[model samples]
Target: MNLNQKKSAFIALGQFLSQFSLDNSARKEGVLHNDLFFDKFIDLIELSQSHNGWFTPEQVHYAINSWAEALTEENLNEWLSAYDLSNVQPKTVGLILAGNIPLVGFHDFLSVLITGHKVLVKTSSNDQKLLPFLADYLIAVASEMADNIEFVEGKLENFDAVIATGSNNTARYFEYYFKDVPSIIRKNRNSVAVLDGKESKEDLVALGEDIFRYFGLGCRNVSKLFVPKGYDFKQFFEAIYEYGDIIHYEKYANNYDYNKAVFLMSLFPLLDNEFLTLKEDSSYASPISSVFYEYYDDLETVKSKLLEDSEKIQCIVSNNLINRSISFGKSQKPKLCDYADNVDTISFLSKI
Candidate 1:
């Protein structure tokens, strides 16, 4: 299909997603192919947890809502207006997706096909169902999309270039294996927040959304805190108390128990609020149930340290304390143009 046709199809897909929400799913009239996909989608959303325990219905719905809001005609235009895709030749782009969060690798999938290239996707086992189901909806909306999408079960070959997401160890394998072709190899990265001890209670409550969303699995989740020395945890803890119910989830509770036990046995001091634990750690990648924190004496030094460790960082959440930092609670809600690892996927696709 042509560019406008492709955009129209995705816009329809977005409309279909918009029908469902965390509070209630109100099926609206005029949505395409709902007779075939809508009820089945509800079933899939309910069935998702059985496929992956972390894929709770709430988390899955949140992901769907984010994508629905992102795929609007205006948002799509804003994101793609910078690229020139008119004269591009179609190459098959192979994708090795990550399953850390629901539909995590979809932007790359959309980028490859929307740029007129065929997509050969190897879905992460943890997220094999959702994207393909959506692809089916797209094909139904515009049948030509069928020719542009493929899912492989074995080795990925016959593709001009590849984009792979994985841990640092798998990245080495991707680098060596795809060394001959142009590729984007992604590795582990974590986000952090800078607190200056003056943030209001509202700010800290919003920051809880950043920490608790997706159960803290996404790279965009704030996994660490950079707070000024002698900062009190009292206000921060009280502000996030609203999210204490998160501890009631079975898997999260298990993780909390196990990780907390490990920390206690290791004699690491902790600030506990029954659900989440705060530990004074220099590392950015914290365990699932905990957030690591470092006491900083100078904001400028923290800024310099973050700049130096830029590669390991995915996002910086702050109240304008760090230049270009994402606002509190906004990290996980990245716009379509918020490319991961600061790598521009659209620009890469246009060139390839």
Candidate 2:
């Protein structure tokens, strides 16, 4: 699409989403602003949660706006310039969607769509409805755009290229089957936060949103913390605890307690029930009930360690501003120019 065409498409999609992304008070309700599509989205999320992702009706608007601009802004598609699509035709690709978090399939779907290829999506059982419904919405808005996309309910046996996401256990399967195709095999990754305990009271509140939103089910959620040694937990805990009432999910509470008991019976003392455990070692992802935190000697030392563990970190949220922060709340809410893994996806696809 040309720049003007892309701009118009995004404006339409954005306007559509902005309509429902508002709360009754007319304030910007990031996720709860669904307008007339509330029931459709809520039903899909209910089913999505049972299998894997814990999606709420609230985060959809942000997600849609992010997806639309990312795909058509022309940045994502620049990757395709490397390949000669005139002779390549529109290749069919398989996308094994990730149910780890909300709208996890978007990147893969996007890579295929903006690249001028056809996507045969294998929906995760837990997140079966959202993507398809999204596809429906896209079709309604721009029917021509939907022609290249297909939401497959089953496996991908006849695709030319592959983009599969899974844990270490399934990485081997991806390796064996997709070895013949040019593909990206993604595994579980943990997001983290780094704190020097120098954050202002206001910054901490915004940082709190990074930790608690979506109840920390996202990979971008800070599963660990890097704190200065001998740091005081009083302010950190209290500032965060003030938002305890914000966490009202019964399942999350149950998980917190069960994990707490396991740690307590073994003589582990927790700061509070509201926060989870923070352990050492490298765990790419954390359970919804707990977090694994680490202590640091200095910024330089921690910086070296994070570089060594780059695969484990996604977006870092910190007040230091020296580098990216260690923790964040939202997952994959990229600006128009925010590329995945800092790699231009469309450029990769266009060249294929």
Candidate 3:
């Protein structure tokens, strides 16, 4: 599509989002947000007190919109137009979807779609419908997109390139299975925070969204923290305690209650904010039941630790890091241009 066409299409899609209000419809259909218009996708989070799944749907909506904005004809000409899609061969790409969070594999799917390659998508049973609905929406806007898309219930092996995301253990199988193909294999990665100890209560409360949203289920969710020595947890916890209703999930409630019991049994030190369960640990990610924190007196020391563990840390949330703060909602707002493992997916696709 040309720049003018792309921009025009984006306006149309954005307006459709406003008019037809798919988000409101999605909220009603969504397990999370069943009533409020603004509550649309934010309500579907499995464990947290459901507030429209914390934009599980709206985030997806904005991302696609952002992509449309960025992929205008002029932008494409600057970055992608020079690359030849016609002479370059088409690739058959296989996408293995993960339902750990909603639309987790959509980035890979978008990479395959936008790059003029064929996608063999393996949808997660837990999230069976969203992709199909999204694709249906896109196909209406771009007719050729359908020709390049395919959804498969089972797995397939023969392909030109692969992008697989799983745990550190499953990465071994991906590496061994797709040896010759150009691939990006991803393992567990979580976001973190390095507090300068000067954050305002308002920012700290917003940071709570980064930590507590989705009950810490996503890569962008801060599973761990780096704080100054003897930092008080009072303001931070109180800022975010209003989200207490996330414990409404019976299963999540059980896990939180169980972890609390275990922490008590082990004599672990914690701050029972009466809302969140915070414990001491040197970890990058947290489960639905708990959040972890560690103290560091030296800023340089914390920087080194963050860099050394960048492989494990997906995002670093802080008052000073603007880029990092932008990712605050990344757990929920993945877009079409973002490839799994942060790969240059369009570049990969142009070659295919």
Candidate 4:
């Protein structure tokens, strides 16, 4: 199939996703194929948690809403306008997805297919159900796409290129194993926020969304904080108190209890608000139920340090304190052009 055909299929998928939301999921009367597939999609979303506890209804709805907003014809056209895809040749691109969050690897899947290439996906065990179900939906919308998508069970074979997402350890293995093929091997990276003392209570509350959304699973979730030296924790704590209900979730409560216990046993100093804990550390990656923080004496020094360690950071959330930094609450709501790891997937696929 051609580019417009591919775009039309995804636009249809977007409309289908737009019908569902956390508060209300009424099927719209005019969405294509709603009579047949809409109810089944709802069934899959409801069954998602039984397959994986982390795939709660709230998280699933959030993912669906994000994609629904993204898959519009205007957004798709604006994103693709930057790339020259007319001369692209067809190839089979292998995808090894990470399952930290719902539909985490859908961007790469969309990229491969939209660029006139076939996709051979190997879904992560943690996220086995969601993507394949969506792939089936896409095939149903565009029967021609059945030839463009495949899910592999055993070894991945007969693919010309690859895109693999994993931890630093697995990334090394991917580099060595796919050494002969053109590839984009992603490693573990975490997002951080730089907080000035001047942020409003509203800003801090939004920051809570960045931290607590998806239970802090996705790489885009802010795992660390950079605050001014002697920054008071009073307002920060109060603003985020609205999200205190997050602790009631059984899995999150378990993590809170366990991590808090481990920290106390280790004699570590922790700032606790019952639901979330703040620990002073220099690392970018933090465990669930906690966020690591560091104090900055000067903004310029922090900027220099972040520039030096750019590769270790996925996104920097700030009030424009640093260049290209995202706003307080906007880290997780990435645009279509907000390429992961700052690598241009469309450009990469176009050349291949």
**On TM-score, who's better, 1 or 2?**
1
Note the Cα lDDT for every prediction shown: 0.95, 0.63, 0.63, 0.94
Clashing pairs in 4: none
Candidate 4 residue-wise lDDT, 1-352, digit = tens:
8889999999999999999998889988778888778888899999999888999999999999999999999999999999999998899999999998999999999999999999999999889998998898899899999999999978899999999999999999999999999999999999999998999999999999999999999999999999999999889999999999999999999999999999999999999999999999999999999999999999998999899989999999988898999998888889999999999999999988
For model 1, residues 1-352, the per-residue Cα lDDT tens digits are 8888889999999999999987899889999999999999999999999999999999999999999999999998888888888888899999999998999999999999889999999999999899999999999999998999999989999999999999999999999999999899999999999999999999999999999999999999999999999999999999999999999999999999999999999999999998999999989999998999999999999999999999999999999999999999899899988999999998888887
- Mind sharing the TM-score for model 4? 0.99
List where candidate 2 sits over 4 angstroms from the true fold.
1-11, 25-53, 59-89, 273-284, 320-332, 336-343
Q: Report, for all candidates in order, the number of backbone clashes.
A: 0, 29, 15, 0
How much does each candidate deviate from the true structure in C-alpha RMSD? Answer: 0.8, 4.7, 6.1, 0.8
Query: After best superposition, candidate 1 residue 301: deviation in angstroms?
Result: 0.2
Q: 87 in model 3: Cα distance from truth in Å?
A: 5.5
Q: If ranked by TM-score, best first, what sequence of candidates would result?
A: 1, 4, 2, 3
